[model samples]
Target: MGALMSVAPEPGWPEPEWHRPPVGGYTADDLDRLPNLPPHTELIDGSLILVSPQTAFHMRAMRLLENRLLEAAPPELDVAREMTVTLGPRDRPEPDVLVVKGEAEPRQTTFQPEDVILAIEVVSAESEARDRNVKPRKYAEAGIRHFWRVEEDKGLPVVYVFELEPATKTYVVSGIYHEQLKVPVPFPIKIDLTAINRRQP
Candidate 1:
């Protein structure tokens, strides 16, 4: 009988190297192990973030703000709060308030910069830095139409309003409102910031 010949397998296949996966990619197990998160915590860019819980004062301010805008907004316009804004696959934020120029939906929906006419962040002692630096830059990069930062330290609803000018990759701080009532909002409608500022938190 002729000797049986064994064919060897091809030799050019890539070798498998066992390396730890990048931290940027988190598995379900990793997510599950995350500490118990407060209501304000949100996942952004695959990192866990702890946001300050909205105080009663904050809620009051937000509601009053929304109501005023609603009154001046076109029947088709929509205003929302604490809703998720997804900037990219890795970035999702829930701003204190968001104003949209479109038909009203029955419920709040996740939004993108394109869906937002304005994004508002309320700054408490803790969140001031993130709101000023992290969010503003992200909103600018995402091409948000406008952004507002309301600081609690001010006597009234002291806010900084910025309009996105993509040509410069930065926001044009169009106006600063010390007295809520005195601010001239550029949108085709008016909102009562004073009313919002008075809400009991």
Candidate 2:
């Protein structure tokens, strides 16, 4: 017996059966187990959400943030890009960038919400609503401490920072940055937004 995903699909090519959802859709645990799923596929409310092709801005910005975060992160924490955090039995959403407590294992694919300290989403035209509205709310509800939403402004990056309000299970805006992002929680950090100008990371 062999797994459906035993052999990797070529770039831009997914398994033909990838579009077919399970009888009840997919659950959080099914993401790694399902062979037909393309990389970066996410399960939201038990439905698989296929990722749209990446734009240059989206690609560059995400990588820049990931690199800057890895550099600024404390020794005890880890930073990963495009990794899913398991929020519940039926919910698993992949953030553009995430910071988690403790060291990363060799094959870990998901992080529990409690282990994620920060979840960052860079807004894309197709996912603006979910990035700005849905995902942050869910991250907060799961008790993740911090969230950041990055949006484009005149072709530059603008970052919005939020802190979880434990009492209400919601996020409250802590600050917004247009050029540089300097934050104290998660870790003391400073990022130069202009670095995304090169258009690739």
Candidate 3:
């Protein structure tokens, strides 16, 4: 007897069939099984939302911010980029940058809300509403203590910092920084946004 083999699709040809989620929607487990998902595909209330691709400016800002945070973070805390934070059974958001407690363990897939100390999102044209409004509410409700949003204005980075109100499960603006990002929570650190936003050669 010979072994059966599946035929591969020809170059430049689409697959004969594609897997689609059920009418109800895809669960977190279902999303986890799919491979080759576009970067920043998130599951929110069982609906998959594709976050827009990061612009070159966004990438540079994120890298610069991450490096600064990593430098100031205490040994008990760690910084990560584009890691999934599980908010609920159907909510898995990949924040642009995040600060978490302790070092990363091997094979860690997603972070629980409690495991995260701060979550940062850089607003993009496509995700402004979600980043500025929707995510803050959700992150607050999940009991994550701190949040920061970076907005690009006139080609410069503007940082907004927030802290959670435990009673209301909401975030209140702590500070807004234009050329500098300075904060006391999660350890005191300062970042020169102007320098970070400068074009790299």
Candidate 4:
């Protein structure tokens, strides 16, 4: 039998090494290769950014909002949750809830910006900045007509709606609703926020 020999650990062993890909180089296809991604992970400007985890309250509010949006959306539109919307070669954001122009095909990997009519983001403490500022700017520039941001005020959801100004590619405040979300753009619809909050209990 040969004498036993011990191998020394390499320098920086046990320390995970990170390779930084060039900015604006990553595409949606690259994002698809990664598996077991966290629920809120997103690709922004070719950077893989892991979003904050959703609190129970945030998820409950998101589900309630989705249900309301679905009930109000037109027959031609479909409301989905946490589906990636491809904004560009380097931008793929997964909105908390979104309304698309038509039924989603089974093999669809991502929704195109033109196909997304409305994008909604529910604010968590950790996601406030991106949800309120970053996403709105990107979604508007991508020509998504409507955007909604849901914020918790006194443990209740308050929704702020915005509509895109096409010429400027910017969003203008459409309405802000606390007890109810009522709007006519895309279609006429009313969501009773009070009722939704009651269901949380």
Estimated TM-score per prediction? 0.72, 0.88, 0.87, 0.85
Off by over 4 Å in 1: 1-22, 25-40, 101-109, 181-186, 189-192, 197-201
State which candidate, 1 or 4, has the greater lDDT: 4
lDDT of 4 by residue, 117-194 (tens): 889888877666778888899999999999999888887789999999999999999889988888888788888887
Model 3, 32: alpha-carbon shift in Å?
2.1
Residue-wise C-alpha lDDT for candidate 2, range 1-201, written one tens digit per residue? 001223445789865554566788668988888775678877777877778778888888888998888889988899988889999988899999999999779899999998999999989887877888878988999999999999998878999999998899999999999888888987799999988866443
Q: What is the C-alpha lDDT of each candidate?
A: 0.63, 0.84, 0.80, 0.78
Output the TM-score of candidate 1: 0.72
Model 3, 98-191: lDDT tens per residue?
9998877888768989899999988888777778888888899999999999998888888999999999999999899998888889799898
Which segments of model 4 are wrong by more than 4 Å? Answer: 1-25, 198-201
Model 1: per-residue lDDT, tens digit, 1-201? 001112233489443221222467433233234444334444455554555445655666567667776666666567887776777765666788888767545653467578788888877666666688887888899988788887754434667889889797688888776544334454564555666546442
Q: Name the 10 consecutive residues with the lowest summed lDDT in model 1.
A: 1-10
**Better model by lDDT: candidate 2 vs candidate 4:** 2
- With a 3 Å backbone cut-off (N, CA, C), the pairs that clash in candidate 2 are none
User: Arrange candidates by TM-score, highest first: which order?
Assistant: 2, 3, 4, 1
Point out the worst 10-residue segment of candidate 4 by lDDT: 1-10
Best by lDDT: 2
